[model samples]
Target: MRPPGGFPIVCHCLLLETPRGLCLVDTGFGIGEAAFGALPGYYRPLIRPVLSDAEAAHAQVTALGYDPRDVRDIVVTHLDADHAGGLRDFPWARVHLHAREHAAATRPATSADKGRYRAKQWAHGVDWMTYDDRGGETLFGLSAIRPLCGLPDLALVPLAGHSRGHSGVAVDTGSGWLLHAGDAYWFHGEVASPPHCPRTLALTQRMIATDHRERLENLARLRELPAEVRVFSAHDPRELDLAVS
Candidate 1:
C-alpha cells in the first residue's frame, strides 16, 4: 500500500516447510506499546512503519492454520526492530542470524541505531544460531550462498550492507529459487529489468548502509540473476502478494 509522500508501506516474511520442519525467514513486528508514547528519551525511531501494531503478524501466522510454536526456526536477515520485533511471540523456535549482526546488536554504541535492535523487546531473549560463511555456490557472480545451520536446502546468503550482518535467506522452492533480499534492495524497481532505483531509495541506503560499496556490488550482481529468481525486499508493497506457504 502507498503511504503518504508516495512511499510504499511494506513488510515481508517467509514461512517454509524446510527439510528441518517449518521455518520463518523474518518475523515482522510485535504488539503496540502505549509506553512508546511515554518514552520521551533521546532514542529516535529511524523509520515509523505503517503497521501501528503487530497483531497483523500474529493474524497472518494463525490464518495460515499454523501455530506460532510450529514455526520452528527463524532466519533473521538482521536485527532491525521491524524484522525482529515479532520475535517475542515465538521463543520455542531457534533463531538463525549472521554472526556480525549478533555482535552488533548485542552491544550498541549509539542511540540512533540502538532502538532498531529490540531483542529485549521480546519476552524470551532470542535463542540464537549465528552463522559464518555458509551458503550454496554463486548467483549472478556474487557469493550469495551460505549453509543455514545444517538445514540442507536453506542457505544464508550474506550480502551485508544495510546493516553489519545483513543477509538474505535463500529457499530453493524446487520449481525455482526465491531470495528474501531483505534491505539489499528495498523495492523491486531498484533491481527490475531496465533497472531503476528511486532517488529516495538510493539516498536512504547511502545514509544507513554500513558498507555502501559492498552493498552496491552485491546489488549489481543481484540484477544479473535470472528473471525467474524471485527477489523480494522487506519493505516492498508487492510482498503482500507472495504466499508464505
Candidate 2:
C-alpha cells in the first residue's frame, strides 16, 4: 500500500544543543529492517516502517555539518525495539533512561517486555544512565521538567505509561519547550478522545506494563501542560513536522 504521507511509523530523535556536546532524544529505525521475535499476532497484521534514507538522525546531523560522533548523550524513553532500535549506530554516546525502565527492559518480570527487545537493536552494553523522581521540580511552574546538567538545556520529563520506565524528552527552545511523549498514546487524537483504545493494544500494554496507572496519569498530565508546549509521540509521524530541526 502507498504510504499515507507518514504511515506505518518511525521514531524521531530530538537534537538539543548542549554544553559538552549535542544530546539525541531517541533513535529512529536502524540501518536495516529490525528483526522481530516470535509473532505477537498483533504484530502480524502490521506493515513495517518505511525508513527514509534522507531522514535518519545520523544523516541529518551530518547534513548539518556536525559529526555524529560528537553526540555525547542519548536519552531513551524506553527499550522497546522501536524506541531503542537505532542505539547501535551511535555507540560512543552515553545513554540515559529511567531506572525503572532500564530494569524492566534489561531485567523484565515476564517475557512480554523482554520479547520486545531485539538483540540487534541494542548491540551496545546496557549502560543507560538513570534519572530519579525529583519532588515536583517545576519549570515555568510546570512540574514535568528535570535537568540534564552537564548536557545543558535538555530535561527529562517522566512520562511513564506506554512502558514501565518510559519518559519524555523536553527541550527548551528559547520561546518554549518541545516534549517527546514516547508511546504514551498511539495517535494524537487519543490524548483527549475519552481515552478509548483498541482492546488488543491496551491489553498488550497492560500485560507488559511495569506501571499502568503511572502511564495513564502521565497522559492526564500531558493534557494539562501549557499550550506553549508541543508534545510528540514515537509512533506519531505527524510530530516530525512539528519537531523538524
Candidate 3:
C-alpha cells in the first residue's frame, strides 16, 4: 500500500518487554552504513536498503531506556539479510529460527540461496537456537511453537513459503494476540479477503518466494485469522505504524 507521500515501506521490528529480558522479533537493516555493497550487485538496486544510526536496534533499545546488552534473545522469522542485519549488534543474544532456515542460511546450496543471505552480518558468532519440532500448540488456526523457551506469551507460527522456514511471531500483547507475519506476505492486501496487491509489489513477492504456491496458501489462511488476533507484515508501513501507536 502506498502512503500519502510515496511507496516507502516500513522496516518494522518488534521489541518485546518481557520479564526475563528483551526479545526482538526480526532486526531491521541494523545500524551503520548501508550494506547494499555487500548485496549481490544485481539485487542492490532492487533492495535499496537504507540504514540509519538511530534505526539500529541497539540505539532504539537505548532510547527505550534499557541497556542494549539486556536484549538476550532474538526470535527470527527468517535469516534474510534485511531481517537479520541487526544480529551483529546483539552478539550476546540467543538467535532463534526455524531449523530449515538455519540450514539454508548456513549452508546455501544454490546460487540463488547464497545470494539471498549475507554472511557478513552473522560473522559475530551468535548463540543460535534452531527449532525442528513438528508439533506445538495451535493459535489462530496455525500450529505454533509451544513454550517458546522463556517467553510464555509468545509463540512461533511456522509460515514457511517465502523462505524455507519463514515464520510469524505471535504475541499475547495483553490487549489481544498480535501476529507479526514476517515476509509471509509483504503487502496487507495479500491477505485481504479478496487477496489483492499492487502488480509490481505482487510480482516482487512471487519472484522472491521460495515456494510460490505454498506462500499463496499461507496467505489465504492468514486472512482467516480471527478479528481479535491482530496480524501485520514486516513491510506494511500503515499496519506497522498503527500497531506502534
Give each model's whole-structure lDDT: 0.73, 0.68, 0.83
Q: What is the Cα-based lDDT of residue 78 in candidate 3?
A: 94
Q: How does candidate 3 fare on TM-score?
A: 0.93
For each of the candidates, the C-alpha root-mean-square deviation to the true structure, in angstroms, is 3.3, 4.0, 2.5
* lDDT string, candidate 2, 1-245, tens digits: 11233334557667777777888888765555324332233443454445555566778888999988988888887777656666776888888887777777667677767676555566557456777776547754345446654755677777776777677877788888777878776656557646565555556556656678877777777777777887778775556666564
Worst 10 residues of 3 by lDDT: 1-10
lDDT of 3: 0.83
Q: Is candidate 1 or candidate 3 better by lDDT?
A: 3
Q: Name model 3 segments beyond 4 Å from true.
A: 1-6, 35-37
Please identify model 1 stretches exceeding 4 Å from their true place: 1-4, 33-46, 52-55, 109-116, 134-140, 242-245
For candidate 1, what is the TM-score? 0.84
Alpha-carbon shift of residue 200 in model 1 (angstroms):
2.2
Q: Which stretches of model 2 miss by more than 4 angstroms?
A: 1-7, 34-47, 51-54, 134-136, 140-145, 192-213
Per-model TM-score on C-alpha atoms = 0.84, 0.80, 0.93
Per residue, candidate 1 scores C-alpha lDDT tens digits across 1-245 of 24234666566888888666678888776555334432223222434455545445656778788776677788889887668766766777889988888888887766745755664655467678987764447754556555666576777788888888899888888898888988898777778777786777678778778889988888887888787877788887766565543
Best by lDDT: 3
